[model samples]
Target: MKWESDPEDFSPSATIVPFDPPLPLLRAPMKAGLGDRPSAGSFVLAFKDAASWRSAFRATESKILEQCELAELAGFSLARQ
Candidate 1:
């Protein structure tokens, strides 16, 4: 409950918002030879719209849970074929 503000903590209404000029990539590959290193990177955890927002959030949460479960399993020995 680290994020809990109170016993009756409630979240304010939120709507999907668009990026004004589109979020810039932290790092992108330069075209051919502009002198920059050839690298391609992206920023995850972004949603397109309301539906996308919901689905992405749920998917991320599930992935996190799955990873946690895997970590827990790592603490014990497993059967092999």
Candidate 2:
């Protein structure tokens, strides 16, 4: 975790609540309370262009678990928003 959102924690939540970064370059993370962290629906890492997304995914393709979309969606769903 030493992400910008939580430099202090190892597995820190990246973004703060309310102000979602714009799409394209960035995608929305799911959110909880107006003051809470991002929720599941916005769990995905969105990109401005498809190519960059594909490239990034390909780079880490081997590490990915859960082969099906359903499973993936469910995983994200259970996660905090």
Best by TM-score: 1
Q: Give every collision pair in model 1.
A: none
For model 1, residues 17-55, the per-residue Cα lDDT tens digits are 555787543333334444444463233233345776676
What are the C-alpha RMSDs, in order, of all predicted structures?
Answer: 16.5, 18.5
Number of clashes found in candidate 1: 0
lDDT for predicted candidate 1 compared with the true structure:
0.57
Q: Rate the local accuracy (lDDT) of all candidates.
A: 0.57, 0.58
Model 2's number of clashes is: 11
Residue 29, candidate 1: how far off, in angstroms? 17
TM-score of 2: 0.23
